[model samples]
Target: MAPVSLKKLVKRYGALEVVHGIDLEVKDREFVALVGPSGCGKSTTLRMIAGLEDVSGGTIEIGDNVVNDLPPRARNISMVFQSYALYPHMTVGENMGFSLKIAGRPPEEIKEKVADAAAILDLTHLLERRPSQLSGGQRQRVAMGRAIVRRPDVFLFDEPLSNLDAKLRTQVRTEIKKLHARMQATMIYVTHDQVEAMTLSDRIVIMRDGHIEQVGTPEEVFNRPLTKFVAGFIGSPPMNMDDVTVADGKLVFASGATLPIPPKFRQSLTSGQKLTFGLRPDDFFPTGHGLNSGDAEAVAELELPVSITEPLGNETLVFVGFNGRDWVSRMLNPRPLPSGQSIKMSFDLSQAHLFDLTTGKSLVA
Candidate 1:
């Protein structure tokens, strides 16, 4: 079934280790993304999976077989790199079939496989065009077609869409999703973009400083982040956070603002405990502009002066001065409000998050 397993994988350059013996499992035909910021060792882990990097310790298995000693070609995995890696002089069809030709496959077999892959990737019409003649999106499709022709058990993509513009990146991302569905091949994609990871992957592995921070489905990580770093990283505008201390069953901010602790976390907290209070823009909004309809008991109302506003057609992002800082709040079906105007804001404490100041871990439990 080609389920890939990595047990205590490690990578080191001399004595300095870059991958800190992380463990992960990819189910057969599932799409998993390894994502993090730059220098997070995500690309390095993907390289090890493709047999392009040597494993310093532990075992890597594809299905039931150990492939640590196997060469790239023998691992039965296809990798599409960040660069298209196409030959300047060769046509798209030639580039797609080059691997098969080098393997001494019959001319008819190579042609058939390449033609099939080209049709699947909508590159049949551009088969004769060289890489230089195609647009960025078309060139990326050709790169994917090359990998498809191999019919490998696993597919590896290393930031394949990062080179494209925003529009082209979205277009290519959709195509890659369709490709995975059609092939039903185990895929491991690595990228630094959180949006790409959230939209493309069935599960995401977030890494930091050579260590895995968390691994879960997009919804699991976003709605219930286990750590403060994850809560800050997974959301679009990011979760708004401020340091506070527990006092008299209330969260006291540095600016002397106080908020009642939500009922769910009241019992777990104690007076004088340091915490980082978090609330998403969606949960903190202008009184009538919020998305939540349920009557939450911990809701707080305050009139805050607006600092600025960003109108995004369907919704406006309002920056209001709260606790001595400009806290962003999402306003749906927005009405134009000039800067310095005071408006009633709602803080949904039921949707709030509390993290230990020292450990950075969620205090929900």
Candidate 2:
């Protein structure tokens, strides 16, 4: 029952407060990711949880006890940093067993623990190799092996895969996921990559300006973002957004382009209200290439000119001219379209999002 609970957590230096009073709960053996752009205080928050940074306000509980006053070692947590932080001179086995050695554990116990972790991480064959002898991915496995030997209640990972190349990152990401399944430890990962957060975490905590924007499962956050920022930030290629004014039950773009207000938002909207219209590339597609198969009544069709096309293997990204700007649409089973050619484009209004322009909040419900 090693659940982690943060109650009104805060971090400050002098008069400058960085992490605001944020509350979060990570269930036992649950993987949670803290993700946001740089300077969002995600790493700071993780450090505070690991006791590497002093808490300025409120309590942090690991399991059933408050750990604010505990030191990093006493808190019984293992952290794997972005920089492998391995001993250059020590062999893989030595590096993994160093913590236990320093703690005055029996030599045989240390050896057994290191061997078990090495086997789990597929490092048994490389136990004799030093950090310099290992590849980037192998070195990362050693880092994870070191953390695994500790057998802590919680595992803290601070952008551990950022240093690796894309291919290596993917490999290590899968390894980390498998490690979590085998260990069932309460792991808290901090990364700026939303893809990593989406693929690795059971739930995601999206942060902005030192504050938590939203916390939800990947599917929840993707299909139903609570705020405009969440909708725009969580998706790759991002959601297309444009400012509009409500007029005669229509959303009128600044360039005089008008679209019928999404049916679901009709009751919540008022004429003359300003809004930010959002539609993902998947929802706005070249007709016959979209993913949606239901509710044609809310779909809007237009003969829009194609501005550009990016062919990506199984699908293509088509940028169409709309509302004085280029709106991207995803095309499946793609066909080559010459630039500037007029094509029938579909906007699945059933999946469109409307946000308050001033507040940047979702208008549905």
TM-score of each: 0.97, 0.98
lDDT of each: 0.91, 0.94
Error of 2 at 151 (Å): 1.0
Task: Specify the poorest-scoring 10-residue window by lDDT in model 2.
Answer: 356-365
Best by TM-score: 2
lDDT of 2 at 100: 96
lDDT (10s digit) by residue, model 1, range 194-300: 99999999999988888888899999888888889888988878889999999999999999999898778988889999999999999999998988747568788
What is the clash tally of candidate 1?
Answer: 0
* lDDT of candidate model 2 versus the reference: 0.94
Best by lDDT: 2
Give candidate 1's error at residue 62 in angstroms.
1.3
Off by over 4 Å in 1: none
- Candidate 2 global TM-score: 0.98
Alpha-carbon RMSD, candidate 1: 1.3
